[model samples]
Target: MNGSLRTILAASIAAMAMTGVARAADVPIVPYVEPVPVGGWYLRGYIGMSNQQLGKLDNVLFTPGTVEFLDSGGFDAAPIYGIGVGYEFNEWFRADLTGEYRGKASFTALDRYDFNGDNIWDGSNDYSANKYEWLLMANAYVDLGTWWGITPYVGGGIGASRNTISNFQDINTPNGGVAYAPSASKWNFAWALHAGAGWEVTQNVTVDLGYRYVDLGDGETGDIVGYNGLNTVNNPMIFDSLTSHDVHLGVRYAFQ
Candidate 1:
């Protein structure tokens, strides 16, 4: 009886070991996966085109009833370049500080004056100038989401602009005396609204295409002086509420 019992016990242990091995073989092996990365520092560079605009020119000589604008003042489209360093706080938020040099844009306008408020025009002034700016801003953005390797975003910025006016001329039409204003610079409050999409090119690189609308408060020139050494009081030429619509193509590289 002792020998029979020992054989049955040994057989049962072997059968249990075999069953455990078969169960292990029936289970599938899981492959390892990489986790998505988030939060990193980035460097950016961009080039863009600016379509600029200006509000009406203001001068004491041309009071409300005394000036009739034949052609309102405006600026020609110009090129823009910028660079910035930014931080991605997460997958859906980021901020940056940027500095940019706005290329010189030419300005032109024409206006007729009725000095005595008589609707009859006495003469017209053909205005011309070149304008440029140094813009610095602190910007923040919200990334809506990502799909097909592309991310869309909306952003805003608040900052300052140093606007410079150069080569300003008022050509008094019809044999009238010409006036000139020296180059001058002014600091203005600036703000912007941005919308864009960024395409991922690599694990650490992206290409951004964007549109922006910016307001550069105002710009002005030095006191106007006549060509023949005549200067008048309160003669500065004011460019009210300068603004621009900009399109940008940029690249960003992340440091991981």
Candidate 2:
């Protein structure tokens, strides 16, 4: 009686253990991972071209005792490039602090003048120089909603620039004269308005192509002198309302 009872109890316990092991193996085990969201710091680099203009030039008439003058003056196109670090505050907002090197431009003015209102001698002079600037700006932008992987944007910047004038020369053919203005540099208040679209090529990279209208204030030269019979000692030559129309192409690398 004792052996039969003990054997039956042991067999029942073994059967229950095997059943529990089978049930445990059949249950699935998978790890749960949360998805990450987007928004982070970025680095940007840009290269562009500027079509520049000199609004007005003065001090050309100082030597002729009220030398009345007529002139055509302008600045040539040049290249500009910059690097920046920025933050994407969200899908709709961003900002950057950038420093740029604006390439040199050729400046020329064809001056037609009469000394003392004399019709006897009508003469002309050409003034030339190379101008360049270094700019630092803080810019903020709004990225409109993306359409077809491209986002339209609008923005503005406020900054300062060091405008430099170099290689200043004056040539007068009629009077067989030559003159020079001292090359100089000036600090000016600068601002810009930007507009364009950005194409999101991948999750962490974007390409931006856009336009900017920048007002670089004014630029000037030191003093001047004329050779031969032409007028020499004059006030500093002024280039007022200096502005540029710029087109930019840039790339951004974003970090998460």
Candidate 3:
């Protein structure tokens, strides 16, 4: 019985030694772990051209008892700039707060009229105006990860704009002598919508291109002329509306 037990113990020790050697040979030399990117804060800036227009303003107020005039058509491309702050919620989504400023845009018009068909009453008229707008917005975006070192994203936002308008007109004699005076000033309030895509240049910097549309409320008008140029003019009325289109490019930074 003792000799049989000794033989079994020897066989078990030999089997365990061979299994350890085989396992070591099968083990790989290198080790690896799946990757995960860290997330935190980010910022960006952009500039682009804007296609701006003011809707038709018809029969705008003028001198009392005098015929109303239509505001001339105006359009232009202006520079636009923006900045933003963002919080990355995950690998694919982020929320941001942004602000943009658009440079001054201006337009003008001129008209000639025959007052009572009298040569002495004939006069030439003019209209001139300018506007400046600023917006504050909030938006959410989806990051499509990276492809060929370029990261593309799309998003939208709602915001408000402060607008100013300056309207002026001049009346002159047939001989070019000044007959009526020039009128000009500023007005404000508009709302806006924005959307765009951006390219990530690095983990910390980004470049963006986008577009926005703004709707400025109607215009407010008051009497411009008086009888004998002394008494106040009644029948004051407000006319006109303002709107604009904007294209922009910007850069941003991310903080981990």
- Decreasing lDDT order of the candidates: 1, 2, 3
RMSD to truth, every model: 1.6, 6.5, 5.2
Better of 1 and 3 by lDDT: 1
Best by lDDT: 1
Q: Let me know the TM-score candidate 1 reaches against the reference structure.
A: 0.95
TM-score of each: 0.95, 0.80, 0.68
lDDT of 3 at 141: 73
Clashing pairs in 3: 43-252, 43-253, 44-251, 44-252, 45-250, 45-251, 46-249, 46-250, 47-249
Residue by residue across 1-256, what tens digits does model 3's lDDT show? 6999999999999999999999999998887886646578887777777777656545433434343344465745667777778888887788888777777666665555555645443555564555556666777777777776566666555655555444433444354543222232334455566666567677667676667676655543334443235423343223356766777777767785
> At residue 214, what lDDT does model 1 achieve?
96
What's the ranking of the predictions by TM-score, best on top? 1, 2, 3
For model 2, what is the C-alpha lDDT against the true structure? Answer: 0.87
Q: Highest TM-score: which candidate?
A: 1
> Which stretches in model 3 have alpha-carbon errors above 4 Å?
1-17, 24-39, 58-71, 110-125, 144-146, 170-192, 216-241
lDDT, residue 21, model 2: 94
- Model 1 scores a C-alpha lDDT of 0.93
Question: What count of clashes does model 1 give?
Answer: 0
